[model samples]
Target: MKAILLIGHGSRAKEAKDVFIKVSNGLQERVKSKVYIAFMENATPSIEDAFVSIREDGVRYVDVLPYFLFEGIHIKEDIPEILREMKEKYDVEIEFKRPIEYHELIIDILIDRLKGAGICI
Candidate 1:
């Protein structure tokens, strides 16, 4: 089976973890694959750790999706660097996916989130 490693920029707040946990759980059910949530900083389960765990779970193919808003330095440099390290370490092949911000649905979701949070559009 395949695996998806949802990598987010980490935050100290439990509420922040809640957001990623919910997304990871949804993905786990929807994709029917092992889903792991990881962070680039300030948290456990770094991208490397997630890749290792997924590989150990018998997932030969892994796709890493950066849970970021844009192609900033973290997306361009840090994430790629981390993926490269993961690729080198893992015996199986791995693929890296683009950020979710490119998807049209994200805008719709963000608008809905704004509404849910009682923010005026």
Candidate 2:
């Protein structure tokens, strides 16, 4: 089956990790595909670890979706590098999606957050 690996720059805060997992679960429901979440650092499941779990579950194709907003080093270099290694080790078809860049929908979400913080722009 096709699977999705949601990648996040793991945070030390429990709340951040919790939010990531919640989003992953939601995505799994919406996409109807097996979804796995992993962190680049400071998280329990690393990319390699998550890959192993999904591979064992018979997932042959993986869409490595980055839960990032910017195209920083992590998005550009780190993820690709890790995915290359994982592909070699697991022999799976892996595709990396770029970070969610600026968009009107993102702007709407930002405005909502700002309004909630009592800071109207």
Candidate 3:
């Protein structure tokens, strides 16, 4: 089976965790493939744990999607490094997708947030 792993830069704040959970749930509903959420730090279900879950679910390939806005250190270096290690250890093949900022929909979402906050842009 194929799976999607949504990687987020975990936050200490409860609200941040809530948001990730909600988004992951939403994606799980919309996509045909299985979707799993994992954090880089400051949260539960680390990447390794997520990989284990994916493997347990009989996932043979995964498309890792970083739930980030930009190509920051986590996107460019940290995630890839972890993925490299996971690929070596697991029986599954994995690849990383570009951050959300690479998508045109992000502009629409940003504009919606700005408008909701009464910030005309």
Candidate 4:
């Protein structure tokens, strides 16, 4: 089976974690495939742990979606390295997707946020 692993750069703040979980939950509901969430650090259910759970569920493939905004070290180096190890260890097909880079929708969202803030954008 195939699954989705949404990776978030976890924060020490509870609110950050809460928001990630909320997004994950919403994604889970909208998608037919199994969806799981993990954090890079400062959070529970690390990527490795999530992989173990996914493997246990007999998921043969995983799409690793990084919930990040840029191609930082974490997106370029850290995540790919970890995913390589996980793929070998779990014997599963893993695809590391790009981060949330520039997109027209992002501009729309920014404009909406500015308007919501009464900035008259």
Candidate 5:
């Protein structure tokens, strides 16, 4: 079976982690495939832990969706390296989805936020 692992750069704030989990749960309800959430640091359910859970569910393939906005060091180096290790250790096929970078929808959202803030944009 296939699963989607949403990876977020963990924050020290509890609300950040909670938001990630909430988003993951909402995604689980919307999609047919299994959904899971993991953090890079400062949080529980690390990437490997999530992989173990996925393996337990007999999910052989995982789509790693990084909840990052740009191709930072985590997206460029750290995440891929960790995923490579996880792939070998768990014996699961892993594929990465690109970070959210430069999309028209993002611009639309920014404009909406600005308008909501009474920026008159």
Candidate 6:
């Protein structure tokens, strides 16, 4: 089965994990793929370790979904660094999925948040 790895900037708050889990849970159904999470820092399941676990779990393919809102250091550098290492280390091939912002629907959510905050639309 295909696998999905959701990569997020790690947070110490339990709420962060809960949020990631909730979102991942919904997405799991759509892809019918194994979904796992990793944090960039300050949380469990570092990307290197996650990749090792998935590889050990016999996952043949992976689509790494970055749980970031914008293109930053992690997206531009840190993630690709780890991914490159994982790719060479793992016998199975892998793919890093793009960030979510390419879709315009994110603007809808931002607009809604602004409206909720009493900003004039």
- Candidate closest to the true structure, highest TM-score: 4
Q: lDDT by residue for model 4 over 1-121, one digit each (tens)?
A: 9999999999999999999999999999999899999999999789999999999999999999999999999998998999999999999999898899999999999999999999975
True-structure lDDT of candidate 5: 0.94
Across 1-121, the per-residue lDDT of candidate 1 in tens digits comes to 7777889999888898888889888878888767788999987778878877887788877778888888889988988887777777886566778776677887898899999999999
The estimated TM-scores of all candidates read 0.84, 0.94, 0.90, 0.96, 0.94, 0.86
Model 5, 1-121: lDDT tens digits are: 9999999999999999889889899999999999989999999889999999999999999999999999999999999999999999999999999998889999999999999999975
**Which ranges in model 5 have alpha carbons more than 4 Å from their true place?**
none
Q: Which pairs of residues collide in candidate 3?
A: none
Once model 3 is optimally superposed onto the true structure by TM-score, how far is the C-alpha of residue 120 displaced, in angstroms?
Answer: 5.7
Q: Each candidate's lDDT (Cα)?
A: 0.82, 0.92, 0.92, 0.95, 0.94, 0.86
- Residue pairs in clash, model 4: none
Residue 105's lDDT within candidate 2 is 97
Best by lDDT: 4
Model 6, 28-108: lDDT tens per residue? 878778898888999988988888889889997888999997888889998998888888888657787777666789888
All-Cα superposition RMSD per candidate: 2.2, 1.2, 1.6, 0.9, 1.1, 1.8
Off by over 4 Å in 4: none
Candidate 6 lDDT for residue 30 = 84
Clashing pairs in 5: none
Give candidate 3's TM-score: 0.90
Candidate achieving higher lDDT, 4 or 6? 4
User: Which of candidates 1 and 6 reaches a greater lDDT?
Assistant: 6
Tens digits of per-residue lDDT, candidate 3, 17-87, equal 99999999999999999899999999988999999999888898999999988999989899999999999
